[model samples]
Target: MSQTVYQQHAYRSNQVPPQKPRPEKTLAQRLLSAGQRMLPWSRPTQTVSTRTAQVSPSQWQKMKTIAPNQECFWNEQTLEGLTGNIWARVYLIFSGLGKFVILYFTPIFIVTLLLTSLVTTGRFGLSDWIEALWAYFLYAIFPASIIWGQFEMYNRSYWKPKLLRKLLDAQKKFELNRRTGMVTLYKRGGKVRYSYPFVEFDCILATTPSQQGLVNYSLLLAHRYSGSMHGVPLGVLVTPHETVAEYYRLWNMIQCYMDVTQPLPDILLLEEARPKDPTTAAYDQQTGRNPRYWRDMSDDAYAEAITQIEAKQSKMSETGPEIDIFAKAS
Candidate 1:
């Protein structure tokens, strides 16, 4: 038997198959990718940490000590220019005359009308007369009031020096300090107009030797021509540190100084700083913590904290002072 020659195939050790070429990206796909990169919200979010700096008790005390009193005054030249315009002077004179007529002559005119009606109709019923008087009064009073307001604005001679003197006297009598004046601007018709000047007076008053730093009083006065034709007494602000009793006492003292016979002005309380626990304070003081870590805190904890804060506020309201300046005088 002939020996069969078996053919054996030899395999190479290092050989690679040819790979197919990759498809090119479409224009739309490239543009979409570029837009995604440019979009603000598409970017990865970064963690941020924020901590509010606590105001120290000493710093608060220093702030109270250094806080200056305010007194506002307009420039003399500006005041002259505003009050001295020929048209403004003419308007002021006419307004004054109109006010006099509305205040003094209107009642007489109404009485005359009532008498004439009675004489003509032989009727003395007050209903018709009163209604007629009311209608006439409304017609005359509205325009007269507006004109009077304009008169007050232009005739600064009565209010300007008087208010300044009052402020000066009050400061000297109360030993109060002045803060920076605040000027407001408004637009009227197509022109800019300056608001009436105003000032704030601040002073620390001690009710008793043992009760030092108990109350802080502030007086706000403004030259308001639109409401009252004279210096408008804004109000007295009483800020008590510990108790509402102190606030009442300080408010009464202010009333006595002003010789106010009417109901006392409203009292505004200062907001108290909330106290934090040691753990929370430490956590807040910590710097460079991942924002996500703080945000991941238990929802229950956040809710509880809010509830506690609200409860504290309610308690404060219950303990705070109640002042109603608008209450009818007894």
Candidate 2:
């Protein structure tokens, strides 16, 4: 087979061949850099950019190489409200009482039935003990039904109705249109909350240290000049990393997905949607790119691919090259 997109770009981060430190900034560049720090010390990180990512060739290479890391971060059908050029996930962490109902309460009832049946059947006196145990279990359901009714009434009243909607509305989808070049955000009810051209938003990445001192990262998109707290979520990386480059990789991935000049990032989840995006369709036709390259991989090969992507990521710069997003905007 001919060389694939990733194969052509794949270089171990360890083999990244030395890069020189950025040259001293010109006076104008220095002022721009200093301006980002003028805000309060608590001002959020990656919060003062003016344009969306304009991913360079090397950044694209790194992003495509690491694309597998992001495949697990998104879901296909969310809220049943999205289709076409969509990225969505569970927007509300505690969307409803459903987890308690399905995971905890139901499991407890099943386990209790099994355990009581086993313990109460250990032949103690009465010849009809098996029948009696089952009869008592069935008889308990009347009181259990009352308890369930009270729980349901309580769950549906007051503060819970807002949360209960999340059983179906928890998904928040971003309508990223490469053709139209817009990024749309949805509300908890799956209504359009905000929409803007992709270039009008800035990528914001924030991380907090756990008690274990490991840092976890979150990706957000905010209209430029918007307050830090106003950012909409762009999913998060569950795996911990030592530095912020993973944020850049993710940002680059978004850029590739939106840029009409480039093909879509080669990730398994996007395989089916590849042909639907204009630029991706064109590029695939020109290169005869295998649509099933990712989906057809064996489980072991997929695991190895992830290892390689991470290995490339680990040895690279802790922070990737800086781009003056303002300049790109100008």
Best candidate, lDDT: 2
Cα lDDT of candidate 2 equals 0.48
Q: What is the lDDT of residue 223 in candidate 1?
A: 26
Q: Flag clash pairs in model 2.
A: none
The sequence of per-residue lDDT tens digits that candidate 2 reaches over residues 1-330 is 112222322222222223233345567755533312111111112111111222233443455454423222222211012322212123222323444444466567667667765887764434455565566456654445544553444334423355434453226465665555556777655778777655556565666667898766666676653332355555332234524555555565555555445565666555656776555678899999988776666666765766676676566542333443333211
Worst 10 residues of 2 by lDDT: 39-48
lDDT of 1 by residue, 1-330 (tens): 001211111101111122222235467645533311110011111110001112333443444344323121211001011112345446657787878877898888878997788787857467877887788768877778777764554344334455433332222111111011122332322133444322121122222323564433322232223322122121222222334333333333332222111111111001110001222223334643332332333545544544564455434322222223223434
Q: What TM-score does each of the candidates earn?
A: 0.22, 0.48
What RMSD value applies to candidate 2?
13.6
What are the runs in model 1 whose C-alpha is more than 4 Å off?
1-83, 153-330
Model 2 compared with the native: what TM-score?
0.48
Candidate 1's displacement at residue 146, Å, is 2.4
lDDT of 2 at 126: 47
